[model samples]
Target chain A: MVDPEIRVVTIDDLGILRSVQEDPATGRVVVTITPTYTGCPAMDVIRADIRRALVATGHPDAEVRTVHKPAWSTDWISDAGRAKLAAAGIAPPAPARRDGVVPLTLAVRCPRCGSPETEQISRFGSTACKALWRCRSCAEPFDHVKAL
Target chain B: MNGPFTFALALGDDSLIAAQRLAEWTTRAPEMEEDVALANIALDQLGAARLLLTYAGELEGAGRDEDALAYLRDDREFRNCLLVELPNGDFAVTMAKLLVLAAYQVPLYTALAVCPDERLAAIGAKARKESAYHLDHAMLWVKRLGDGTEESHRRMQAGVDQIWPYVDELFTTWPDAPVDPAVLRPGFDDTVTEVLTTATLTVPQVSWTPAGGRDGVHTEHLSYLLAEMQVLHRAHPGARW
Candidate 1:
């Protein structure tokens, strides 16, 4: 199912959907997901959507387990998902910064004009998953999926 | 006090209270983006609180769940440090509080990430990443406001001084904790000092070491905060959205 927020990216494409184990014999299914953020409000909706999808596929007994051992990272977003996000006017995240270094962002190319002349408007946006940015080239405001 | 249950409860209470305090900034922050930022940080704290409280309840082996532990408890039952329970004084004060809270949490969670407790470790492994972000955000604001202008610098310093006395309570010894609170002090000091120095703010020097939140002795502010927070649940028990 597509992400309830972004709408253009599927759960698989976003990689929050960790694994799905299904038993054809008993029609039993177990799905595991790691939340993009520990406080992500989307998890409940995503779980419900997964259950609905499973029921539609004839897997009536399904277990959706949430795990946190291996934390979620923006790097998990697939390349195709990035493409879909850019196509939808939302800038995909930059490479996940490592070693806890405060990333010095040199540039964020405007999704609309592909020019590196974009400025961050705020460190936060409409949702926890993205930041607000303004494109200098196109003079358009956009959301950038923040790198965590 | 030695039980892991109380240890987890204390940690949970810290996050829960912090979340509630941050959430108070919703619709009231100085700017629209700040409103969203505080709300999101509040959500993160709430998220971590839920996991810790759930684990604490399980460890207690009592009938209490996260909601029961959270909603049914009164101020005296809460284990959050006074720093979190204090009223949001001003924008600078709020940022100062966030700076210290996130500074402490990052090291605490990072230490928890490698601790022997599997569940806490999992929670920590996930939470440390988020705490790092929170810490970064707070540092940015602290430095900006601390060094910005004459009035801004004065207010930021005052904010740090106002919140400083309560800071010592967070690092008191907890022998049964996954990572003893004392052990986390050095890291916390390092992080806070650097940010404060860069921000042109002093790390307030205070002789008063008021403590005892672990044993559920909180300040008067907690009672009022809990009255507002737990009122809905107490009025309509077990109500859900």
Candidate 2:
């Protein structure tokens, strides 16, 4: 039995690879992915990568489809994902409000220096999903996953 | 309350209206990647509309949520530009339109991120990133198509030919419009021209441009799209998915 937690953490930490499904007919798998943001350049490569991984694991004919509905959110990261994120040296997304209103003090910490003393340089980073951050502790720049 | 909600409607209308047009190419794009790309862009636009409209409904406090406003409104009520509502003629044509509009919107959101209204600013913050990717995606295609084979170049030119007339409507300001175009990003035309030059495509020369979407006067295509989009919501009011 595959541990659901590991899958959760892997997806959460990587911030890609949205959902996986196994086909009962041929025992093949289909993975449903949503890009981190709408215009992610790596999405096509990621889709192909997912297909390759599934095929390498004996699901050669497995089909993968990308879905955009209900949209992916940073809030979907599970506890296991948070742990993986911490271990990966990246800070996890701050908790979300049930009321759907973002709190004012929800500043992201720099992963490299582990300092909350950072500022948002831009809403965009190296990739579409991350925001650029400059750490006060190390004064090094890094990307922080923006809250959805 | 009125200004914020109206501004939100302008944003929402832009996305919802654009998505409707992009959805027309769902199964008809040149290739699979193109299909997915178009659909993904459409979905992103739709999602943007949903977010903005939901916020607008909350601010209005009139018991009209996103669903009610999106589904129940007539064409005249929408505040989108005519450029978004124009039909997708061919791949190059669609890409040309995308290049123009996305070029306009990327800077528009970049500046809007600093808006005094926190919600608008926050939404703009998120949208700025999304629209950048969108603009890049479309711009990449514009370059590929423009510099490709002779047949490809012809189609690309033809695409521009068909879409050139509609471009002027995007920057026009209407006195009674929901969002003032003057308050939008300046030099929109210049930015579009720069993008065209970068793509190795010449900007089409046109004298007359169509404009009328803000007041709900849309081409006949819009009614058909609305009919298809709102059927489920209209038939079963208050339906949730």
Candidate 3:
């Protein structure tokens, strides 16, 4: 059987898995996911998607659980996911700052023109996970995945 | 009611009502970007409400789920602060109210993050991060509008003054609560003062303070808000989109 982690990653493409393991005798895959944020709406969708992916992979019964131990950080997003975001015209989040001091403005490089001269138009964007930014070089508006 | 159950429900009601008010700004905000931002913020609050309400149901050992608790409850049964139930009068009012609530939530959730209850603590940890963003958003707008044109400054200060009476209730506390509301006062005061200072706005000095939402007493606005919010759910019970 394929690893459940791979299935979860394939389904969500957010690289949110903390761990996944299958019981050898019971064939029940137990998947653990770390939520992007406490109030993130994606967690529910991700849980259902993980279950569906496992079922499609011949594991009919699987348990999807959430863990909040180390908490989720933007650093958990994989390289492939970051690339996907960039390709989709969404600037990927910068590495999270540990000091809890939020900068008044973030220097988000535009995904379209790769310009560093992007200004935040809004603190929030199309979704809670992103911020709206306008690129000076391209003069195009894009979403920047927020660092959290 | 059990301590955790009541506590969770209070927090849940606060988020749910705040979400409803925020959602109303979707098409009415001054700008398209503001509309999108308000909706995002509303969705975040809604998500938090769902988690807390679901946990509350579990703690109560009641058969009610998140939907039941959210849609089926009467206004008098809700435990949200009166500040959240007030109508979203204008963009300035919305921002001012959000600033106060978000500032309060930052410290409330931060303290709750260390509660003995593991699930509540986990929720608190996650919520604290979201509240920080909410506070930041409110702060920026409050500053911009308060320090902007004369008209903008007038509206912003009016919004602050209007909401000030409802502020005192947010610091009320009960025994066995996840975090004492009084304990959050210092942090709340500092945060609000910092933003108001930058905005060049003075805090309102109101002699009369409004209270009683925690004990299920709410302003008349709550009924209308609940009617609108609960309509579709009431129309089609058990319906899912």
Candidate 4:
């Protein structure tokens, strides 16, 4: 299913869908999902969507579990998903260094014009997962999925 | 007091109270971007607080949930450090507070990530990633405002001085806590000093450090914050949207 917030990508594409398994004890379909951010309001909606999908697929006895062990990261977003995000006018993130250093500001290219000249308008955007940026070449504003 | 219970409770309270304070800037931040940034950080704090408080309640085994522990308790019952409970006196003050708070949390949560406690480790590992972002954001602002204009520099220095005394309370040693606060002090000092130095702000050398927030003795400001935060929850008791 597409993310309830960003409809350009599916849950699998976004990497929030962690696993689908069958419980040994209860013999029920168990689906596990991870959240990109702890306070993401989309989680409840995603859970409800997963449940609805299961009901439609004849697995009314499904169990959806939320896990937080390894934490979610922007690195998990698939390449195809990144393309989709760009096509939708949202710039995808570069690989985030795991050492927690904030990268330099001048790297993000404009999604619309593919120009390397872009300035960050805000570190935060319309959604928690993205940042606001404006292209110098095309002069169009866009969103960039933040590299966590 | 149960050491683990108190430890978890204190950390959780820190996050909860800090989140509330940051969220107060939702529409009132000087700019729209800042409004979103502070709210985003606030959301991260709230998320960590939920995981922490839920675990704390389980450790206590007293039937209290995150909501009950967060909403039902009076200010006197809170175990948060005084730093978080203080008012957002100025924009610079808010940045100063965030810089200090995130500095402490990055090390604290990083240490906790590898600690022996399973649930705490998991939560720590997850939340630390977000804390790193908060630290970066705070550092950016602290430097920008602290080194900007003469007036901006003056206010930023004042903000740091106002908040510095509260900093000592956060690093009080709790050897029994999941990750002892003493161990995290060095990292905090390093981060804060580097930022303040680059920003051309003097690190305050205050002799009189007022504390006692961990034991629930907070400034009167906490009561007003709590009154607003808990009002809706207390009014409806089990309210849900």
Off by over 4 Å in 3: A1-13, A38-41, A68-70, A99-101
Q: What TM-score against the true fold does each predicted structure earn?
A: 0.97, 0.64, 0.93, 0.97
lDDT of 3: 0.84
Tell how far residue B205 is off in model 3, in angstroms.
Answer: 1.2
Task: Report the lDDT of model 4 for residue A31.
Answer: 93
Candidate 1 Cα outliers beyond 4 Å, as residue runs? A23-27
Q: Predictions ranked by lDDT, top down?
A: 4, 1, 3, 2
What docking grade applies to model 1?
medium
Q: What is chain B's TM-score across the candidates, in the order shown?
A: 0.98, 0.90, 0.98, 0.98
- Tens-digit per-residue lDDT, A1-148, candidate 4: 9999999899999999999998888778999999998878799999999999999998999999998878788899999999999999999998877765556564998999999999999988887788899999999999999887
Give the per-residue lDDT digits (tens) of candidate 4, residues B1-241: 7988888899999999999999999999999999999999999899999999999999999999999999999988999999998999889999999999999999888888889998899888888888988998999999998899999999999999999988888898887788999888888999999999999999999897888898999999999999999899999988798
What tens-digit string does per-residue lDDT give for candidate 1 at B1-241? 3478888998899999999999999999999989999999999899999999999999988778999999999888888888999999999999999999999988888889889999999888778777887888899999999999999999999999988998889999878677998988888898899999998888888998788887888889999888899899999987899
Better of 2 and 3 by lDDT: 3
Position B78, candidate 1: lDDT:
87
In model 3, residue pairs whose N, Cα or C atoms come closer than 3 Å (at least 3 residues apart or on different chains), thus clashing, are none
Q: Please tell me which model should have the higher lDDT, number 1 or number 4.
A: 4
lDDT of 2 by residue, B1-241 (tens): 3667777887788888888889889888777556666777777787678778888888888988888888998777887877787778777878888987787777666666666766666666656656765776676777788778888878887887788887667666634433356555356677666666776678888988777775667878777777888898899987665
Candidate 1's TM-score on the B chain: 0.98
**lDDT leader:** 4
The local distance difference test score of model 2 is 0.69
Return the TM-score for candidate 1, rounded to 2 decimals: 0.97
